[model samples]
Target chain A: MYLAKIFVTHKKSILDPQGEAIKNALHRLDYEAVENVSQGKYFETTLNCDSEDKAKQITDSICDSLLANPNMETYRFEIEKVGD
Target chain B: MKFAVISFPGSNCDYDMYYAIKDILKEPVEMVSCDTESLDGFDAVLIPGGFSYGDYLRSGAIAKFAKVMPALIKFANLGKPVLGVCNGFQILTEVGLLPGSLQNNRDMQFISEYEPLIVQNNKTIFTNEYEKAESIMIPIAHGEGNYYCNETELESLKQNHQIIFTYENNPNGSVSNIAGITNKNGNVMGMMPHPERAVEKILGSEDGVRLFTSILKSFKGGILVE
Candidate 1:
């Protein structure tokens, strides 16, 4: 089996309201060193594919077709081999 | 003329759209389920606003893959009028029927109120009843209605006169104050405001009536009795 870990985040050009709110809260709590905070989603999936390359291809397609909105977000994934 | 109000799962505004067409606009309207693939016998298609598929992953993300979407695309390609309101607008962008994506409001709040909109282009079938630069009041209710597109796409929209409505005071921080836009062909429109909700004076403003009437007029070869 192969495992896929995907991370999705708003594109740099797009505004991140939720992330902005969090950053504001952090400032209020005296986290002065944190200048910015952007929010995103992470997904972990175990595929039935035997090869890591095959698992990566399937995961990339999934992210492109469903997990991410290309208009506002970008996504990247990492694949690792797991035990059968 | 006959209109079809597509009812996707979790579509709360489908009935409002149907009522607006049948009773207010005095036209025949039917409710078509999103699971259906055919879109025949309809003069125009209205995709109503709601949290389709519970807005999983992203607004309109899952709904774009519905069985009815392919037919909707084909219908739009045939130069038939297609109107999408709020969540329906998000679906259109998700399905590539329209440009831009709706993000959360700049204030990060769900806003439900009546706002004034300026008609930027009144030449299209969707806004012919309104005068250029005319201001009309419409109700907008959504958490994610801030429209965003790349600078290149925005320039193209401006060049093609695809921008139909712009918020008067810029309610949700949509790019260039864009409240609504149409496709290059001018037959497909995706707007964040709920015109169906404003069709009756009792509900609020009746200014939205002109949008539907305009579509009806276009179907009748540009002759509107009213």
Candidate 2:
């Protein structure tokens, strides 16, 4: 078994509306000095596979195909062999 | 034509849609709960606008795993027509049925007003009633309705004419002023406005009546007369 964790985010320079909203909220609450915020989703999943390399391949494909938008967002994946 | 409007627990616009379809358009409609397993009989499935699950854990994140979404996916995959409005639009993007993420409004505040929507693509089942480049007024009420898709996807969408409606004045800061989009097959549509609310003159606008009528016309195997 392997555990894969992924982080999906908008590419740098793309505006993040959620992050901007949070920044606005902070300023409204008087936290005026808070600067530069970005929001992203973190996904962790366990996959049953033969080897670490095979798990990596499957996980990468999922990220590219559906898990994350390769064009607007970039994703990073970490895989580890684990005993269930 | 038979249509079903899926109502989530926190959904507030189910009856609005029901009245829009049944009362205004004089079409037979069903108010279906979000957990319904069978959508095989309906000609169209509508995910009405509302703040589902009280907008928890991101706008449509929690509603994605509802009982009826799997059935909705099946309905969409079979090339049936599906329309998601407002919160329903957010839900579609979250489920990967649509391409972009609907984030907070550009001003970081909830906006509720009548905004002009320019029809960009009239080839889809949803927009067939309108002439290309026509503009109509509809109400948008959302705190998080900004649409974001990468540049590559944006170009492809334009190339394919998948972008159906664009904001007339950049209301929510959506990329390229996009207000709505259709799936690659053009069967599914998701938009960030409440067309149902604008279906009657009593609501201050009747421009939305054409949308429902257009869809019904298509289902009857006829083109929109207007």
Which model scores highest in TM-score? 1
Clash pairs, model 1 backbone: none
Tens digits of lDDT, candidate 1, B1-226: 9899999898999999999998999999999999989999998999999999999889999998999989999999988999999999999999999998999999898999999999999999988889999999999999999999999999999999999999998888899999999999888999999899989889989999999989988889843211
TM-score of chain B of 1: 0.97
User: Once model 1 is optimally superposed onto the true structure by TM-score, how far is the C-alpha of residue A7 displaced, in angstroms?
Assistant: 0.3
Strongest candidate by DockQ: 1
Q: How close is candidate 2 to the true structure, as a TM-score?
A: 0.80
Candidate 1: C-alpha lDDT: 0.92
TM-score of chain B of each: 0.97, 0.96
Residue B109's lDDT in candidate 2? 79
How would you encode candidate 2's per-residue C-alpha lDDT over A1-84 as one tens digit per residue? 999998888677777777887888899999978997778879888999988899889988978756665435788989987886
lDDT of each: 0.92, 0.85
